[model samples]
Target chain A: MQVNGVEIEDTFAEAFRMVGSRILITACSRQWALQAATTMTGFATSVIGCGCEAGLEREVEPEETPDGRPGTSVLLFAMSKKSLADQLIKRIGQCVMTSPTSACYNFLESSETVLVGGKLRYFGDGYQISKLLGGRRFWRIPVMEGEFLIEESFGVQEAVGGGNFLILGQDLESTLRATERAVAEIGKVRGVITPFPGGIVRSGSKVSSKYKFLRASSNTPYCPTIRSLVDSQLSEAVNCVLEIVIDGLEKTEVGEAMRVGIRAACLPGIVRISAGNYGGALGQYHFYLRDILGGTLG
Target chain B: MDKVILRLKERSNIPVEAEAICPDLFLTKSQQEIEELALYYGNKGRRLGDFFQVQGERSDNIVIEGEIPNFKKIGQGMSRGNIHIQGDVGMHLGALMKGGRILVEGNVSDWLGAEMEGGSIRVKGNAGHLVGAAYRGSSRGMRGGEIIVEGDGGSEVGELMRRGLIVIGGRAGDFVGAFLIAGTIVVLGPVGLRPGAGMKRGTIVAFQEPDLLPTFHYNCLCQLSFLRIYLHHLREEDLNIPQEYLGGFYKRYNGDTLELGKGEILVWAGQVA
Candidate 1:
C-alpha cells in the first residue's frame, strides 16, 4: 500500500499485554506539577531496562484534580504486577513526595485495586493518617511541607505495549521534521504515549546474534548508514530511519495513532514505512500497516 | 417508602434517639411495634410511640414533629434507616451511628454525630459541640461518615476524629480540629483559636482567618492542587463553591509542630500562591 507517494509495508506491529496505571499529581502550581511528573517519568522508556515505561498523559485544570490544584495526569506500565507496584512506590516516594507542595492521587478508583498509599504510608513512620471523604480513602503522611496526601489505590487495566512504526525519509533532517509534527499530534490524545527519548528512537534493536550472550541486538536490516556492514533492508532511497514506540491503555487507540500518524508522516521526505512484530499474536491485538494505510496505498 | 408526605406531629418534648429506628428496622415492624422502641428522656425511659405518632405505614423513614427540646441520642448506632426531625432535638442526636442518614430541620443539641463510624447526618440548623467527633477518653470518632451543618456549630467539632469529613456552613467555636488524627474539617465560618492543635495529620480549611498557635510552624506559601479536586467533589452536590476557595491561593502551614509536624493548616490569606 502506498500513502501519497510513500509505500506502506504489509507487515503488522505486535504488542504485548501490560499492566497499566494512571497517577494524578497536584501541585501548588502547574510548573511544580510538571516538574514532578517529568522527574518521575524520567529514565522510564522501556521496561526491559528501566522496569517500567511512563509518560505524561495530559495537563489537568484545578477543577479536575483532587485537593483543587493544578495537576498533571501520568501513565505508567510494567511487565509484572509486582514491578508495577514497586515502581510506583519508589518513584512516588522519591519524586512526588520530595516535590514541594505536591500531592499524589490515583486517577482511577475502584474496589480490588493495588493500594499505592496503603504501601507508601510507611514513609510516615507511625504518624500517617487515613482520611476517607465521599467514599474515597486518602492517606495523609506528615511531611516536612505540611502533609502529602495520596489516594489509597489506583485502578489497573490490561493495556497494550510496543506499538510502533518507523519514520523513514531521504535524510535525517526530513525524518526529524516528520517525527516532530507526529509527536505533537499524538502527545495528549488520551490513553497513548511515545515513550522513546524525545518521542523518537534512533537505534532500534532486533533479535540477538553477533554476541551469543546478548538475546537482542541492533536492527541492522534498517541501518542505512551501515548497509554494507550489515544485512540492510533499506530500499536505496531510504537514507535515515527512526522508530516511535507507543503504549496505549487500549489497543484501538494505538491502532488509531498508527492510522492517522502514518498518513501524516508519509507525506514529504519519506519512502516505505514498516513496523516491528514478534511474529504471532501471543494473545495481543495486532494492527496491520496495510489495513490502516490501505486507502493511501490505492 | 413514600417520603415527602410523612409529616411528624409537632410539640413533643420527649428526647428520643432516632438512628436506631432506621428504615430497615421499620419495614417489617408495625407502627405499634416500632413505637415500642425505648428512649431515655429526663432521667426516665419512654417508648417511641408515646412521644410521637407513627404516620407512614410502608416506609422505614420516621418523621418526628414538635419542639423536642430534650431529644437525646436520636439515631444512636443506626445501620440502615433515615430519621427526619422537623423540630429542635436535644443532645447526642447521632452518636455511634454506623450507616443511614439523619436530617434535622431545626437546631440540634450537643454531641451531634459523636463517634459515628458510617452514614451521613446533615442538619440544616445549628449544631452543638463535638459534631463528627469523639468525646474524652475515646481515640477514634466518626470513622466513616459525613456531617453537613447548614448553620453554626459549637466547640470541639471533629475533635479527636480519626477519619471522615465535616463541612460547616456557619460559625464554629474553639478547638475546631483539636487532636485530629485523620479527617477533613471545612468550616465556611470563622474558626476559633488553636484550630488543629495536637493534630498528627489532618486538614483544617476555614473560609475566614484562623488563629494559629505558637506550636504551628510556617511551612511556605503555595497553592494546593487537591483543593480543586476537593471542590469538584463539592460540586457533586450541585452546589456552587467560591472560586477563591477552590482555585485560590493560601499560606500552607505544617504544624501542630508540638506533635509530629506532619499535620497541615491551610490558611486562606486572600492570595493564590
Candidate 2:
C-alpha cells in the first residue's frame, strides 16, 4: 500500500493488555491544575523503567468537573492492579497534596475499588475527615491552603498497551524527521497512550535471549540501507525505521492512530515502512499495518 | 405566619414521625394512607396514629389546622418522603432521616435534625435548642445532609456534627457548631456567643456577625481567594444569601485551639481582609 507516494510495508503492529485508570485533578485555576497534574504524571512515561505509564488525557473546563473548577483529567496505566494503586498513592500524595489550592478527583471509572484518596488520607493523621456527597466520598485533608478534597477511590478497568508501528527511513536525520511528524499527528489520537518518553522510542527491542535474565533485546535484523553484501531487511534506499507504539481504549483506536501516523510520515526521503509485531507470536492485540492504513481490518 | 395549604390526596402519611412535613413524600404515596399516618403520635409504646384527624384523600400533603405543640420526633428515620406541618411542632424534628425532604411551615421544638444521616430539612420558623445536634450520649451528629432554618434558632445548632451542612437565615442561639468534625454551616443572621466553641474540624460561615469563642485565635488576615471562588460557586447554587454578603470579607478564625486546630469560622465582617 502506498500512502502519499510512501510505500506501506506489509507488517503488523503488536499490542498487549494493561490496566488503566483516569483521575481528574482540579485546582483554583487552570495553571495550578496543570502544574499539579504535570507533576503527578511526571517520570511516568513507560512501564519499562518508570513502573507505569501516565499522561494528561485532557484539560477540562469548570463545567466539565465535578466541583466545577478548571481541571485536567490524567490517565495512569500499569501492568498490574497493585502497581496502579501504588503508583497513584505515591504520586498523588507527593504532587497534588503538596500543591497549593489544588484538589484531585476521580475522572474516569466511578467505583469504590481503587483507593487513591483513601490511601492518602493518612497525611491528615487521625484528623483526616471523610464526607460523602450525593453518594461519592470525598476526603477533606487539612492543608496550608484550607483543605484538599479528593475522591475516596478511583475505578480501574482493563486496557491495551504496546500497540506499535515502525517508520523506516534512509538516514538518522530523515528517520528522526519522519518520526517527529508521525508523533505529532498520532498525539492527536484520543483514548490511547504513548507511554514512551515524548511518545517516541529510539532504541527498539526484539524478543529475548542474550542472557538468562533478559526477556528481550534490540532488533538487529533491519540495520541499514548501505550498498553491501549483508543479510538485511532494508532496500538500497531504506536506512532506518522509527517505531510509534500506542496504548488506547480499544484495538481500533490504536489502529486508527497508526493510520494517521503513517499518513503523516509519507514524506520525502522515507522509504518502505513497516511494523514490528511478534509475527503473530507475542502480544494478544494485532493491528496489521497494511490493513489499518488501507482502511481494512480482519 | 401565612398558612401553607396541604392537600392529602396521595401518599400515606403513615405515622410520619419526623417533626416537619415535606412535599416530596406525596409524590409516591396515596392520599388515604397519609391521613391515616399523620394522625399517628407514638409516645412510650403507643402508635403515632393516635394524634390528628384523618382528612380528605386528595394530595400527599397533610395540613394541620391547629397547634401541634406536643408532637415529638416527627418524621423520624424516614428515607423517601415529605411532610408539611401547619402549627408549632414538638422536639427532635427530622431526627434521623436518610432520604427525602422535610419542610416545616411553623415553629419547632428542640433537637431538630439530630443524628440525620442524609436528606434535607427546612424549617420556616423558630426552633428549640440542639438543631442538627447529636443525640443524648452519642458524639456522632448528622453525618451527611442539609438543614435550613428561616427564623431564629436555639443553642447548640450543629452540636457534634461529623458531616453535612446547615444554613440558618435568622439569628442562631449560643454555641453553634460546638464540636463540628467536618462539613459546612452558614448562618446569615447573628450567631450568639461561643460559636465553634469546641469544634475540631469543619467550617462555619456566619454572614451577619459572629461572637467567636476565646478559644479561637485570630489567624493571619489575608484576602481569602478561595472564599471568592467558593462564594461564586454558592452563588450558582439555590443558596439564600444576600448579594452584599457574597462579596464581603470574612474574618478567618482558625481554632477550637482546644482541639486539633483544624476548625475554621469565616465570619462575613464586610471587609476585604
Query: Tens digit of lDDT per residue, candidate 2, span B1-273?
Result: 222244323333233353434334434444445434443334333322344444444343445555666656766777765567766777777788887777778898898889998888878888889988898799788878888787888898899898887877788899998888877777778989899988998888877667667788886543343344345545554556565564455677888999977898987777455
- Interface RMSD values for all candidates: 3.5, 5.0
List candidate 1 segments past 4 Å from native.
A110-112, A118-130, A135-149, A226-232, A281-283, A292-298, B1-5, B17-20, B27-72, B81-87, B135-139, B174-182, B191-242, B245-273
**Tens-digit lDDT string for candidate 1 (B71-116):** 5666677776688887788888778888888988899978898999
**Per-candidate local distance difference test:** 0.79, 0.74
True contacts kept of each: 0.58, 0.06
Per-residue C-alpha lDDT of model 2 across residues A179-291, encoded as one tens digit per residue: 88888888788777676667788778778766999887767666563336445677867767677777776667778888888888888888877888777876788888788
Candidate number with greatest lDDT: 1
lDDT by residue (A41-121, candidate 1, tens digit) is: 999998888999999988999778667678999989998777888999989989998998889988854344677889889
For candidate 1 chain A, the 10 contiguous residues with the lowest summed lDDT are A289-298
